[model samples]
Target: MKRYARILAFGAALAATVISSSAAQAETILKASHQFPGGKGDIRDEMVQLIAREVAAAKVGLTIQVFPGSSLFKPNDQWNAVTRGLLDITSFPLDYASGRHPEFSATLMPGLVGNFDRAMRLNDSPFMKNIKSIIEKQGAIVIADAWLSGAFASKKGCITAPDTMKGQVIRAAGPAFEEMLAAAGASIGSMPSSEIYSGMQTGVLDAANTSSASFVSYRLFEQVKCLTAPGENALWFMYEPVLMSKRIFEGLNADQQKAILAAGEKAEAYFNEEVRKGDQLMIDTFKKAGVEVVEMSKADYDAWLAIAKQSAYKNFAAKVPGGEKLIEEALAVK
Candidate 1:
């Protein structure tokens, strides 16, 4: 009996040691990258960081390291990197990859999403479903669905009317917005949001269109004299979501995958709660700096939408397959 007891104890200790070794071997570290500034209240960065924290707390043998402010990948290159498995994850603006996937241009189309509520509603719409389908096909998957509303800031004048953009050198975020601004007679200069400050400071850009959070985060009030903030007739809404490489995601064990997904949900919920405050912060910060802030009137919005239909909308429908259907699906939400 004594001999049998000793043998059983040895077997139990060996099994415990093997399980401990396996658990240690299972820990994984993923790199998460984004273009926004970290540790400075950029909502996009906060989203990524929240994911990191949540996953760490889950104790699921998974850890994420965040690289913000274009530290790891340039803004436009993140989509390509993540989809190719060179990057583990990213907080990315989907339209930035539209050069390779023309259908993604619809995500940033003018007048497609005009307000926070509509932006939220569109997440479940066929338009986004199609967008996500494309993402999956490209070897990445959306972790969080984030829609940011933006506005125009001009050193020349308030950009409330189509004519106001005339002759001004402008930096618009994506191809669709650039097309619309070009049709309005503005000279278009393309650059990432991080460059907007320097572009305006050096006279390379007389105006820019970007998210409200960027205005405050980049201190654009120091560069531009007037801001066209989003109000009742918001015009610019862009989908910027946290994404993971499908290939990398598939490599994770089931527990690690569950932890990552849960972290994403928590991060998304945090964004929805903070985004409105971010917009307000932009408005207040600009006002305190004595920059003129204006909202687009209903009439102004209608005029811009009409121009968009003629230029951006018309071009997209004619160029991209199934583009018209995507627009119809987005509009049908309301």
Candidate 2:
């Protein structure tokens, strides 16, 4: 009977070792989704892969499964998906969630951010701290800050003046931008950037303002006759950071959480470099496709800014919480 008892103890000890081994090898997988495609050398795809690689390098049993091109969730639904725990992470345009979280509207307010350098600086500002608190309250965390400069695509001609928007049905990325166009005399049709192609195809949209990467990725040049491409003089830049669910992030082990954040930092640098490259790529692609590529000049930008302040900025400050102060800090980036 004593021998049998000893044998039973030994069996229990072996089972415990096996269980420990399995636990050590288990991977903590977070599914990351985005509205862009996973293309070869595509910055969005490449950066996501970098994040995955960094987490793996940490050897903390943490990894990310990427669902690019909005396969996991649509662009408009990503924030809701992540916050509700239906999705774990996303490369989200903060402005897209402005409807639900009005404070996010200021992130894409016209004339607030135009250059990558200033956008990076904004990340360290008290304004960003306030934005972070607002987002955290909504159950998400900003993992990476991405400032992707964008441009205007038009069906008939270059969109230079407020009058150029008159009577046109445009797809502006955010409500703030739409308000500016409306105040200038344009009909607004809200849709995610990914749907710009279809909107143009159906003739429902006469113009769109979107990221440089998306301009090329969706081949808007084929549908539109002209593009006000991103460059040294552009006011269409956007803040589309990669975000993770606060619930998921907080539930992670310390090592795993650190790995995720470290990976995000690395990916953000990649984003800045590649987004600039994308701007040039969009210009080349549009020109090569026989689309007239117009650039915003000092005068043109000033005109847009004038209207934006009176319409977009004013509307945002009046509606979104703390938006006026946020705009003050954003414009002070100089």
Candidate 3:
């Protein structure tokens, strides 16, 4: 009888232990938000969605719930949400928070990133290191680094040289670009990229500058009369990264964290492969719509760069602390 009692007690203890372990390993769900069209092949939305799929496949008790097209949070408001842990993850445009951190203006500075190759190099350069450090200090960390090449579209005419910007009201994505456009004699209006189509439709915007993917996804080809596609010397490039709340990430178990990191790597690789295709698709979509498409000539790019140096570059160097050094670091990437 004593032996039987001991065996029963051992079985009970094992059952309790198993229950405890299962409870400890309960599924964790992370909420991710972005301002891009969901289920429509927008690469930005797909990046977050891909991470969700990859992490779930790892079976590490992690799940990601994505809220795209600003359903969960406003586009410009997402940065603060991630920092404060209100949102677990986000696909954020770094420049949208330039007002909070002046140094971020450098991320979207005019003519800073000329093309995709330089963008990849800049990811590993001191410039991005500094930017990432700031992100960490602010309670967020970059999961995937994405640089999107953009173009200028106008209902008025093609925006090629600084002189062409005269008498046009344009939506430049960041302060640095705003300074350059204003110097080039274009009127500046502040709005998120998601609103560009409506802004133009309502006659509030005569021209706009944004990512090729956004231009395509938002169907801006229907609104603008002329599209300045990014050619060899692309001028507009912005760093839009997948970001996670540092506190939330740190709270995750080791297996969960590993899954998240691996997913991020996959998402970054996917973006690099698909981004160029997005640009071409925008060009084709616009041309098929009968909207005139043009590219900036080498001379035209040089002219814009000279104007940016005088206005955007000069102002950034003078205003933001260590801003000049940041620009120098990016330029040194070659």
Candidate 4:
């Protein structure tokens, strides 16, 4: 009987040691990358930091390492990298992945989303659900939902009127907007926003379209002489969501998934609030920089919309499968 009791005690000790070893080795690590600068000031950076804070506070045996300003991957490469598991997550603009899914180009369709409230409703909207469905199949999921409104800038003059862009070189953020700019008779320049600075300086770009926040963040105001800001409502609205690879997310335990998702949702709310304020803040930044700033007027906006209908809208419906249904769903959002 004494010998039997000793064996039982030894078995209990071994079980406890095994459990402790499992606990020590169970940490889940996520590598997050983005094109925006991290640390502070910038909204994306701040939100990502907030997410990290919340994760740490939860103590879910999970940790995420952040790489900002394309340190880990280029802006265009981040999406595919996340899907390939070379990256775990990214703060990505969907339009950049339009090549992977042409339907994604609709996210940047002119006048589709002009303000925060309408833009915020997109994730649940049927139109966006369809888009998300396609993205989910490609091995990624949106952990955060945020939209950014954009504006146009020119080197010598404002691109307020469609006719004004005649014969000028321009960068129109994405293909949809690019089609509109091309219809306006502007020669389209293909490059990322980071390249826009040097492009403008070297006479490669006469006018460029980008997010309101980027206008100030990239300091293009210092490089360009004229800035067109989103005033009240603008045609350029891009859906920039932080996406996580489905394989990595599904690999987490329920507790870890819950904690990370909750953090991501909170970060998205913070991002939306920052983006709303950023529109006006960028305009102010440009004005103070001694740059001539112009807001798109209603008449010019209407004219641009007319051009877009013939260019971007028509092309999307003809080219992308189910594009017509998506457009109808988006237009019926109101």
Candidate 5:
């Protein structure tokens, strides 16, 4: 009887231990948020999903819970939410935060950084290192950087020269963009991309500037009749920052950090490829939609660059601490 009793006690103890161990192995949930609608199927969402998959594969006890379409916060509030640890991760355009960190406006500066290859190199270069330190000071870590090709859409007609843009009511997103359009003699109304389509249909806007992805996502093609050529003035290559709260990142173990970084690298590569392919598809779609694609003259492009160098850079430098240094480093990245 004593031996049977001992055997029962041992079995119970082993079962309890197994249950506790299993509980401990359960995945930790990390919440990620973005401003886009969940159904949009944008590249940003794809990258987040990729990270979640990688985390699961590594069996690191980490799981990502994505909050799409700004359910937790609006697009402009995303940075603050992430920094305050309300969101574990987020990806957004750096230009959106220029009011908080004016140097970030450099990311949208006209004629500053052109082409994906050059932009990618600059992202990993010393320029990003400095920018990263600044962002960290605000309580977030920038893990990946990417550029989306921008284009101009007009409700009335195509604009092929700076002179033709005069008196146009153009909807632009950032101060630098507003300045660029203003320099080209267009009347500027700054608004979020979400508001652009309606702004055009109601005649609140005559032109709008955005990426090809945006044109399609917002269905702006239905209202706009033309798309400026891809390479002309490089439109406005928006830079996206893949960021996480500093506290969340620091709490991770070393091995976990390695997995996150590795996954981020893969996400970055995939993002670049997707943006390129998406741009081409958008171009083809625009052509099929009967949108006239026009390229600006070299002289006009040069004139715009000269104006940006003199006015935009100076205005931006005055607003941001160490802004000129940031610009110099970015331009020097080659």
Candidate 6:
């Protein structure tokens, strides 16, 4: 009878432990938010979903519930929202936080890194280390850094030279882009990507500078008649940050953190692949839409670069704190 009683007690303890573990697993749900629309099917959205799905699959007692399209906070407010623990996770434009850390704005500066590969390497280097520290100081963790390829879409003729941009009102999204447009002799208007089509239709904007992928996602080709052929100019790339709220991250177990980081690294690779492919697709889509795509001459490209070096770089470095160092490091990337 004594032996039987001991056996029963052990069974009960095991059952209780199993139930407790189940409860712990069920309780570990992470809420993630993004400015991109949930149903958009864009690369950013796809990458975020990939992270969520993979993280959950790892079964690290964590699940990520995504709130996309700024459902929880506006695009510009996402960084602070995550930092303040209002959200568990978020992905936002790093340049959008320029107001908080001017060095972050360096991501948007024209002609910083030559191409996506170099840009990605630099982002994972010490250049990003400084920015990461600053972002962490605001109470968030940077998991992934990604970029998009910028292109020129217009309603009129293809823009082949810097001078062609003069007198045209171009819509620019971030600060560096705004400066880039203004320096090129085009009037700049700050507008969200969602409003771009309407802006073009209403004559509020004559041309716009944005990622090739975004041009397709936003369906700007329907309104714009031309796209400077792919690689016509240095594509304006925007740095995207996949961040986690420090409070929530700190609450996670070490195993869960490892799972999340692993998922993030995978997502980063997938995100870059999608961006590169999407950029090419956008260029192809533009050509199919009867849009005139023009390639600028090397001389023209050099001229624009010269203007960017003289005006965009000088002005950006002067205004943004640590901007010079950021530029120096970015350019130094081999």
Q: In order, what lDDT does every prediction score? A: 0.92, 0.85, 0.94, 0.86, 0.80, 0.79
What's the TM-score of every candidate structure? 0.93, 0.91, 0.93, 0.92, 0.90, 0.89
Candidate 1 residue pairs in clash (backbone atoms < 3 Å): none
The residue pairs found clashing in candidate 4 are none
TM-score of 4: 0.92
Better of 3 and 6 by TM-score: 3
Which 10-residue window of candidate 2 scores lowest in summed lDDT?
Answer: 39-48
Superposed model 2: Cα runs more than 4 Å off: 1-25
Candidate 6 Cα outliers beyond 4 Å, as residue runs: 1-26
Give the per-residue lDDT digits (tens) of candidate 1, residues 1-334: 9999999999999999999999888878899999998888899999999999999999988889999999999998999899999999999988899999999999999988988888899999989999999999999999999999898999988999899999999999889999999999999999999999999999999999999888888889999889998888888988999999999999998888998999999999899889978778999999999999999899999999999999999999999999999999999999
Q: Give the range where candidate 1 is weakest over 10 consecutive residues by summed lDDT.
A: 272-281
Which candidate gets the maximum lDDT versus the true structure?
A: 3
TM-score of 2: 0.91
lDDT of 3 by residue, 83-131 (tens): 9999999999999999999999988988889888889999998899999
Evaluation by TM-score, superior candidate among 2 and 5: 2
**Candidate 4 displacement at residue 4 in angstroms:** 26
Tens-place lDDT digits, model 5, residues 1-334? 9999999999999999998798677657888887655667577777877887887788777888888767877888888888888889897777888888887888888778767778788877888888788789999987767688777879778876667788999987688878877987999877777678889988899998877677777778788888886664574677877898999999898877877788888888888888877767777878888887776677767877777777788888877788888889988987
* Candidate 4 wrongly placed segments (more than 4 Å): 1-24
Residue-level lDDT of model 2, residues 202-302, one tens digit each, is: 99999999888888888788899989876667788788888889999999999899989999999998787777778888888899999998887788788
161-251: candidate 4 lDDT, tens digit per residue = 8898899899888899989989989999998876788898898889899888777777898888888888865999999888889999898
**Model 2, C-alpha of 301: deviation from truth (Å):** 1.2
Q: What's model 6's TM-score?
A: 0.89
- Look at candidate 5 and tell me the lDDT of residue 222: 83
